[model samples]
Target: MDVEILARIQFAFTIAFHYIYPPLSIGLGLIMVFMEGMYIKTGNKQYEILTRFWLKIFAITFGIGVATGIIMEFEFGTNWAVYSRYVGDIFGSALAAEGLFAFGLESAFLGILLFGWNRVSPKVHFISTIGVFLGSMFSAVWIVVANSWQQTPAGYHIVGEGFNARAEVTDFWAMVFNPSSVDRIIHVWQGAFLAGAFLVLSVHAYYLLKERYVEISKKAFKIALGIATVISLTQLLSGHSSAEVVAENQPAKLAAMEGHYEESGSADLYLFGWVNDETQEVTGLKIPGGLSFMIDQDFEAPVTGLNAFPKEDRPGQVNAVFQFYHIMISIGMFLIGLTLYASYLWWKGRLFEKKWLLKIFAFSVLLPQIANQVGWFAAEMGRQPWIVYGHLRTNEGFSQEVSSNQILFSLILFLVVYAILFLLFIYSVNKKIKHGPYDEAKNPDEFLKYVS
Candidate 1:
């Protein structure tokens, strides 16, 4: 196989697997804060128990996310030597900011939030949990800002000889607010919220099915479901706005998504289909004028079709974009449906009473995960052929000095290392969850200054 293809596959494989943890951790970080916050506000033992239970899971995900992410950093140097040399100056700054803004805050407070539970006062512990939550989110902001620059290069000028087009940050703030930043950030944050929310609901649902921690799990399910509903809805809106940006800035991608070919009135949106370049149309269910309306806010608006772009400029990986987009929308819709149903059950005071639904929820907690993964695939794959959008192609991003053999070796090494880390993470998390908080080595106030 070709080296570029191997590099792409290797990066995507590792990143996709690694991606699961960060969002889960980010989302769970919020849940940790909320649960602990509730315990503080209400002085409720149930909320405290809930906080203890989920914290184990949070730790598991955080460890895996960090471990997996470290590989990507190395891969940038090993696999994409050329690409790194070109964009390193600009990219390095964002990574550094992430360390400062996100990692700094999270790591600083994490000690207090975790091991300090009994070592500090309730109020102090609660504050530490909140810090962890903010730090996780802050980390997200800098990371997204960096990725945003790749999608829509800004605050930078292209320089250097014909061999490499070096990207340098011209205006720091402008780089942060690239044209696609808001839409991408909102969508990403919402997805993280859903991941966290669904995880809470799913685990609680499992306990509900077993009739364990009945009242407490019920409370968690209601809170998580409610949050999931709101964020899922907002995700839909953000997706719409994001698509609009793609339409204006990356029309070829939009055309590939819609399977539009030939200049036609009122572009149609394919619900599900296979776009055959040879036949020049999608073979499946489609919505007439939906494409045009989505893109231009008018049913009769003109949309550039795939025919308009030369083969070289056209987004080559159309099939992946089409499938991933469909999966993303479908999953988002399902989340809305599930959240609404859960809300109704909660309102009726019959949420946990419905064991069948709880069983479904037990397995469905991973759905947002699927949507999150596919949505990400669509976003990244949709930008195909370009590492820095219009500025440079991905093939051109590699370092001439790097060898495929080295990348292959690193890829194998990454797989082995990640496998071991993941197993340990799962073991530690399950062990902690199973142990429960009913009995602890010390009092909950051991770290807390609270005197009861």
Candidate 2:
């Protein structure tokens, strides 16, 4: 009802909507690079066709990612002026690096990747594909570094006083390589890869079911499956490593994540549970002391719980944090199981023969997206009451002059615009999938027209 709630909702809505596209772009970029590289390696026309088909999809995602992202920059100044000013010195450098090192490289090679297909040599074009992929990855690095720094503030010192106080970087590299940055970055990259790989698998699985582009779809599906399998396993490791980081640096957040209430007690890993904060109880299945073993290799090790922290400093939405975190973990484990089963079926030489498995693959694309979204929701919400860890309270960060009515109006406007953009994206991608990959053997002139 007030500016704080309205402003948080507005920014969260805008950022969450914007978040959907970047992972897709980053993930899709990796897939495109692999597809184009395969084309070059074998001089296979089918690989080229696959590369070209996905390139169109990649372009759509990249364009929308850029457009939706611009709004968040403006929102920083308009809705969170104090927060922006506080972190300006830190974010300014990171964003500048992204523009200089990441966006520039991706944008430069994009022309060669899209329009210079026939004009450039095959090797040169493949290089361009790698360039674009690396660029997207580097962009992710800077963004993650900036955000991770907020979660675990480092290399910064306070300046000024009260409302005038701000953080200025004391050590640039220390800030860049903040305690949580590397773990978070790796986790983010794996999530993005899963998002992209599942999308490719889903689309190709559909084509196979329809008996359209059967041979090409088989190749694409196999490649995506392999990627998905490897990333799913590594993602599990990354998640564990990230949890360790949280256990050490953000005990309150970790406490909230598992609904642990005792001041110094062994924490149980919940397979699934409902946290009733009123009575400080959790109901549902759990591995007793599993969390303690995971954190310290001891079943009875005492993990600092929410009771150890001041009530005002603890996360208010404990149930939401616990639920979001468990949902992410559940989806992650399911993906690992799904990809491994699909891999086993492929090894048995009956991958495509199982129509039921193919049907699951066709719909599995939503899982990774859901996991990425909820994983973020848990992380952000768990860090509640603080905009910059222990440094600044969230309530103290918003623009003082902004009104609830103004934020509400803009939020409504954003919802309308984003809905339209989402529709446009779905329609465009659907049309491309229906048309299928272009067949150079069947229509030589059409291929020529495409390259020209």
Cα miss at 1, model 1 (Å)?
A: 1.3
Model 2, range 1-452, lDDT digits (tens) per residue? 99999998988888888888889988988888788889888987778888888988999999999999999999999999999999999999899999999999999998998888889998999899999999999999999999999999999899988788999999999999999999999999999999999999999989888887788888889899999999999999999999999999999999999999999999999999999999999998999999999999999999999999999899999999999999999999999999999999899998999999899989999999989999999999999889999988999999999889999999999999999999999999999888777632346554543331
Task: Please give the clash total of every predicted structure, in order.
Answer: 10, 0
**Which residue segments of model 2 deviate by more than 4 Å?**
439-452
- List the candidates' TM-scores in order: 0.94, 0.97
- Whole-model Cα lDDT per candidate? 0.80, 0.92
Q: How much is the lDDT of residue 212 in candidate 1?
A: 63
The candidate scoring highest on TM-score is 2
> For this target, which candidate reaches the highest lDDT against the unseen true structure?
2
Query: In model 1, where is the ten-residue run with the lowest total lDDT?
Result: 443-452
User: Which clashing pairs does model 2 show?
Assistant: none
How displaced is residue 189 in candidate 2, in Å?
Answer: 0.5
Root-mean-square deviation of Cα positions for candidate 2 versus the true structure, in angstroms: 2.5
Q: Across residues 1-452, which tens digit of lDDT does each residue of candidate 1 receive? A: 66787788789989988988988988888777778788898987777877877887887788778878887888788778778877877888888988988899988998887798778999998888889888888888878888888888889877785666588888988888889887888888889988998878877777777766566677787778878888888889999999898888887777777778765557898788887777776788988888898877788888888778778777777877888888888889888888788788778887667778888888887898999899878878878788878877888876566667866776788788878877887688667645544443256554232211
